[model samples]
Target: MNQEDQELQTEKKGNKVLVVGASGLIGISAIEAFLDAGWIVVGASRRKPILLSGRTLEHIKVDLLNKEDVFKTFQKYKDITHVVYAALYEKPNDLVAGWSDEEQIKINDQMLRNVIEPLIAVGAPLKHVSILQGTKAYGVHLHPINIPARESDPRDNHPNFYFDQQDYISEAGIKHGFHWTVLRPQLVTGKIAGALNILPAIGVYAAIRKEKGESFSFPGGPSFVWELADADLVGQVLLWSATSPNAADEIFNVTNGDVFEWRSVWPALAKTLDVQTGVDHSFSMAAYIEENKDVWAKVVEKYGLLNHDLNAFIGQGHAHADFAFAYGAPQGPVAFVSTIKLRQAGFFKVIDTRDALTEALQSFIDRKLLPPSIA
Candidate 1:
């Protein structure tokens, strides 16, 4: 067996975990990873997740914003030993604009506190807590980030819940004698529909283009290097952080260990979806996806795919895609972050961006969540 496999084999099993935001990409990936590793998993979210690979994840419906509800719900799970806080709240209608909103910051901070404080109060044997942050923490949204943003870089003073939650967790860790790891990944890709992961939105866009008998063109503005984090890889890191000494109380920036320019990677994406790639055809993916819902429905019906209504299936993904693709911008931002710390810390996992995107897109097609590419 490989060293990592051996390590997983030796690790203790049957530790119960509470995965908040069970319906999201990272949460679903983490749940699957934990279950496969023999961890007793319970998921928390307002919406129960569909059965994962036929494994029925024990789920609890609770709103993280409702403090009393969160406390009441969590108090019952006294045996919970680990927490993966992957829940996120994005403004539904005005997704990007709300990122810097004070109310957004407050709500996110409270959500983290509501979940963790209650678990601590109920005296759950919380060994470790892992929460997520993204490129936004480095103020990438407002301005250019350091070429390769490092975790040790000075905080980009911003109106972000990441800071508030980090401060809260750091203090809590010291006070309660627990370990916490913060992961900041760039462009997380996964198969979950209606989550921030951009793969599904891309799938829908491809399906729509193929259905219209149009070439799969690069719809963004300019070429720029970008990084990606596979949801499964993020899950593995979460598992690593749960017990690895290197991960204890550490903040790590993670990616697929390589970079790709959208224009360069376009062919691979097109090949995976069996579509023909065209030259740069810059347009708003956010606007296009929003405008093509009826077309998506027809594609779904024609291909005998699942009924993933555009808005529900795409979530804020179209908007996130625009952000990732740098649509409507003069040039794409060079948003690369340092994963050296992550590697030096002993988690030596990596996946190519092309393969990562291929695997993610194929997953939806295999599940029939998205239509197969046009012949």
Candidate 2:
């Protein structure tokens, strides 16, 4: 077999994994990756996700915030040997404001505890647990982060759900005789739609601009260098964390191994979306998307796309996109996080950022969530 085939071929280790937040970007990617690697995957979320590949996904609807519901629902899955806690709770109307909110921290902490405590109580054979964090852990949202932030960097002096969840999992891992890994991924992009992922929001914006015969202008302020982690790559790392001895009870900062400015990549992104790039025009993605509901509906009809309305189609992605693009800011800090820790742990996989993003957008188009790029 060829090297590519060899790399893709993974031995099934007789593992059953429960993936929470199955509808979000990280969750969707982890599900597909685990299934491809020959693991029995059970997905859980409040809403059932539509797999982009149209594969049958075994799913359970459970709210992580509802402790009793989560506990009762998970009690039957005592056979689960692994868990990927990719679920998140964000303020729907004011996504950014919730970051520092005490209630947000409490809710997120409870969510993690709710899921894992029940599993432990039921005596599930959980060998490893994987959890997700982001650049926010480095205080990128509140202050400038250290250039090339390392996994060993001092914890940002901020009240964050990440800290609460990490402490809980670490103590539990020791007491419950299971391993845990914390992964901090930078600007994750993937195929899942109508969630917090930015790709779908960008695709819809481009399609709307195309429909209006306008250029897909850069809608943010001064550009800043940034890194990205492919959701698929993050999924693979999750797999590696489960079995790699080096990953047990460790934290990793994951990225695509390169960086790019938004302005530098705008042309390529626009080309991939079948739109022409225009001069930078600073604006808020959230506001723009909110104002273009009817236009998006018209685009959906024109393209024979899924009939989800703009709000349902965008989810909280508009706000996330605005944050990611540094909208309305005169300048933004260059945020880079080191992945050398992950590489040293022996999972040295990487993807070109341009290809990773373009391919993700193409997947959305193939899934009928975005209009055709060719047309």
Candidate 3:
């Protein structure tokens, strides 16, 4: 047999894994990677299974919000050895002020009780549990002390669902007897088959503007810094965390190991989409969306898309916009460990940020998640 065939045969010899939120961007990649490594994977999603190749995969419809459903599913796979938790409620635009504090707490608190707590209680022979988290846990609006925010940075004083969920996992994991690892990644992007990304939204907007022969502008100032990480790299980290002895009961910050000013990334994106960049106008996403309410409406109406409440979307969008442009000006290069810790533990894979972005954009085109005009 050829070397390629021999390598594939060797990889088909690993362990069994159970992946929650298998339908999400990161989860799908994790499932694929684990399967490629020769692990028997059982994926649970609220929807149908994602088609995968090369390994045995079983998909089950699971409602993580329902305790009984979660329990029943785990009971069937009680013998499974590893668990990856990637399921999460999409952060609502109104998460900041629209909902009552009590309401927000209740929804997030119950998710922990119904899902994570049960896994802990069952004490399934899980050698490790890797929980997916984001940079938002550090605080959405507050300026982080450094550009590459470290895992040790103090969390924002503001309370939110992510903080609550992190607390729940920390508390529950300690009592439940499994080694737990948390991975906090910043803005993950990659070749997702049926996923949407903030970058693509920009691409689509730029594409439409180009098709209509209109100019494009960058909203928010150009000074903000946004850190981007590849979803495939994040998946690598997840698998590494699951098996690495150093990662047990610890949290790690995952990023692309570099920070980019939005000005640079935005224009690069515009160039990739063949759209005109730098139209000499600037506004925060909030102000732009508000001022151009009619324009956004026209775009939505022309495309026959669902009308997203501009005011609300803009509120969250502006926070991201502000961070993208202004975050690192005050903070010197945010000194977070990119794969430093993981590498020390012998997991040394690295992802090229530009290539990751290009591959992701192409995947969006191939899957029709975004239009060809955008490419």
lDDT per residue for candidate 2 within 1-375, as digits (tens), equals: 887556545434567999999988888888888888778999999988667667867899998888889899999888889999999988768888889999989999999999998899999988999999988999988888898899999999998999999999999999999999999999888777667888888988998888888889988877788899999899989988877789999999999888878888788888889899988888997888778878988988988997477777777888988888888766775788988888888988889998888898888787788888888
Winning model by lDDT: 2
Output the lDDT of residue 42, model 1. Answer: 94
Model 3 score (lDDT): 0.62
User: What are the per-model numbers of colliding residue pairs?
Assistant: 0, 0, 8
- Residue 97 deviation, candidate 2, in Å? 1.4
Clashing pairs in model 3, backbone N/Cα/C closer than 3 A: 146-334, 147-334, 148-334, 223-325, 224-324, 224-325, 224-326, 225-324
List candidate 2 segments past 4 Å from native: 1-12
- For 49-99, candidate 1 gives per-residue lDDT tens digits of 774577887899999999998999888888988899999888777777899
Q: In candidate 2, residue 180 scores what lDDT?
A: 96
Give per-residue lDDT, candidate 2, residue 354.
89
lDDT rank, highest first? 2, 1, 3
Clashing pairs in 1: none
Off by over 4 Å in 3: 1-14, 49-56, 95-102, 120-123, 146-148, 154-156, 193-196, 283-339, 373-375
